[model samples]
Target: MVSRPHGGRLVRRVLPRDRLEDILRDSRGLHQLDVDDTIYRDLENIGYGVYSPLTGFLDSVELESVLLTMRLSNDLPWTIPIVLDIDEEARRSIGIGDTVLLRYGGQPVGLLMVEEVYRYDKRLYAEKVFKTTDPAHPGVARVMSMGDYLVGGSVEYIPMVRDGYEDYFLTPMETRVLFRERGWETVVAFQTRNVPHLGHEYVQKTALTFVDGLFINPVIGRKKRGDFRDEVILEAYKTLINRFYPRGSVVMSIVRYAMRYAGPREAIHHAVMRKNFGATHFIVGRDHAGVGNYYGRYEAQEIFSEFPDLGITPLFFREFFYCRGCGGMSNEKICPHDRDLRIYISGTRIRESLSRGVVPPGEMMRREVAETILSFENPFVE
Candidate 1:
């Protein structure tokens, strides 16, 4: 049995002290949270670049609101002060030791069972210190090389909310165990906070060609106002899988955790979390976890190469395009259609169409998916 701290206003969590210390040292970039230039500079100081999913979800105003949530909200169980992962004010409040129970549409869906905290050692950090003018100065190149060695493994634990214990779905461990027990050699997971589009179908189907199974996991937690309802997405997927995909080839489920929209970083974290749930691989595509052009098109793909220890191979698929020549959905190589022949349904454009009661074409969405979007109230519009 484990003990939990008491206090309605204070969030409580359990974490290893050594790991917490390393995280504090490694995450020094948090301080430069607001300024994009400074934030990137700090990331570079730590041997990384700045590109995240939150780029589109955050602006000056929203960033400040999230910052307040990080500092002032009691709902979060993790204790660390969320540093500037987004615009100056954008942040999340959960420290090292807390348990996060996630829900979707009033149903407990899953939990982020975090444990086994690892941090960067000062010795490793010391080894990387460089003196610009001194020949004896240590080279940071050494430190960057040891980043994975410093903190490479993950912890095992479960999440729960006191009053809603049963509602706290206990599937992370079971899911991992069951997948391993079965003969499924590879499982590739996809994360979504949006409705499925033609492009999504292309990726998931493409992933199925290589992996034994595909998990179409959609985040059903708190999302942007304009985002479609969880039920709509789920029902549409069900219709799609039944009519189009091979039976038992795809497993669609809801991942009801509030999104950080931290783009590339979030993609890494999502892949790691899915690995914890027993996925052997993840499908990452252009603008993954992205809202707008704040992060580059391929930034998420680039970040995966930076962390090789993850062991989860990111199957990077090219963007999908509708080729009039092929008369169906296709990727860059297979599609010979010119710019004028293609039809795209961006999140912004989809929402715009829905606001006016217009269903997007099969090019942007399937007929069933389009109908589903039209039936629902436009959260962004009303």
Candidate 2:
């Protein structure tokens, strides 16, 4: 059976086309606020059930719960805080039960039923969510940049934004339907921000051997400098999937959620999203969602033990490298070859090679994938 969604039900906050048209008839007079592309992505995810059990931005209570307990107000395991922060004075005239139209890119993208507007301590949020107050950390930097107020309420999303890679975008509902139609009762989701390499392939196929299908979900959004561009990751995966995987055994999709780099907490958050997408299992790598040296290598794996009720099974594998002795990718759990014969698969090395117009050796990345990546003039995010 497919795993149940995080809150035991899929949320549908999207307004139907006819209903949206009706609402827009009075849109000009509504109290409106402007947000960024990240909030637009959040609205889409919330409406489409990617963030199941959460119909709106977190209220003060829910935000406190998630920040301290790493769970929602109802005790469901939720890690990252999904919030709508605005300037403090923005809510002065807005009372509870009011409706605020949220605009992005000069268009009304969604509506929020204003339930509560509250203030929070920025450094505390930084310390609790990202575990550090250092401005160098991307997550902390975002926290520092947020407004003084958070508005919480249910959302009525009007899918106005076109996140790139429209051809491959799949909502939670769509993925669930496709999984069932294909009879994939045990699908394993592999999330990635970087282009695939042989190390990735070895881990994915090894997991696929135990599951009915593989969900190749790429996390797409504002990634850090030097990370592969969204299109590069998708195109490279398409090439690898079509050329190597068996037919009808894989589904490629994109999730346009911004990365928080919150280490262990983000791992659980990732699992919950994939679980909502009908994946029975999720792959958690060492330093999952970790940036720099902020977290221990196994922290992400160890955090799973706290949430035994989290529906998706987490598959933890040791770091992999190519062993000359075995002439294949092998992890510490398998290959017994001496270190001298091993060519550890490093994403940095591959990126450096590609940046220099040199294709990484086949031991690290497939020749086809390397070529595809090389074809891009500047594949990394600037």
Candidate 3:
């Protein structure tokens, strides 16, 4: 059977449809705060049980504990803090024991029962979560741009944020049911924010050899510039799986959460999320969820050692590259090829080639996937 959700039970915080009207009517008297896209994604995860064991945004005490030790106040293995930041005016207007309607795109999506309103040190948060205080880092930049005050409270969802990919979005509960229906007792999840390359394919296929099902759960949230758009990613994966992967062996779904690029910590977060989705194993490859050189390439794989009973096994992989000596894609541990025989394609090279209207080599990405990527006019122009 698939593993239990992280921290035991799956949390379901969304109220029944019949009861939402009554809650909305009562919430009219409470303050309302419009959240940004990032905060909205966080709320969606919390309410949908993607971030189970977390009923709401973290209060100051929980936030501090997470930042300092990568654990929640309850000492569970939580890497990043789920916080709802607000401007000074909203902070002044809302206080402990008050209720606030959390809106996204000018629509009431949930209600936050306020528990704490506090200020945090952004630099400290950046350094603690991302191991950097430099604003050039996208994760750090996002941290620096956040509002000074954070509002913590349990959330009640009225309408979950779907972001136009509702058909591909599946909550943890839904995914577990799907796995059960497929008779997949052992499911391995592969997390991605980019279009699949040959290296990624290698990882997935490698995991498939051991598991009954492969779950491709891509992050469908706000990404940095030059990253593939959500639609492009979904379509590319569809093409990849339909043409290459065996039918009934793979499943694709969207996990709506902004990338934190917190490297090792983010890997933990990813594994925990997959565990919640009933995955018995998770793939942690080189620089998983990493952006730049801020983290060592293999740090994400190494981080899993810190959490012994994470309940989900981490399938660690080294950097995969085309080895001309072996005439196939191979990693350092298996291939004895020298540097001269190893062919590696960096994401920058692929992006540059795509921008120049050139398809990346089949060695790096499948020709079908590359053509799908090129179908868009400068797919990474954003």
Among the numbered candidates, top TM-score falls to 2
Candidate 1 local lDDT, 208-305, one digit each (tens)? 89888877776654444566766667667777878889877776765544444445655765675565456777889887765434457888789776
The best candidate in terms of lDDT: 2
By the TM-score metric, which is better: model 1 or model 2? 2
**Candidate 1: segments with Cα more than 4 A from true spot:** 1-170, 177-182, 377-382
Residue lDDT tens for model 3, 132-166? 99889998998899999998889976665446888
Q: How do the predictions measure up, each by TM-score?
A: 0.57, 0.97, 0.95
Residue 311 displacement (Å), model 3: 1.4
120-193, model 2: which lDDT tens digit per residue? 98898899888899999988998899888899999989887776578888888888889999998899999998
Candidate 3's TM-score reads: 0.95
Clash totals for all models, in order?
16, 0, 0
Provide the RMSD of all predictions against the true structure, rounded to 1 decimal. 14.9, 1.3, 1.7
* Order of candidate numbers by TM-score, starting with the best: 2, 3, 1
Better of 1 and 3 by lDDT: 3
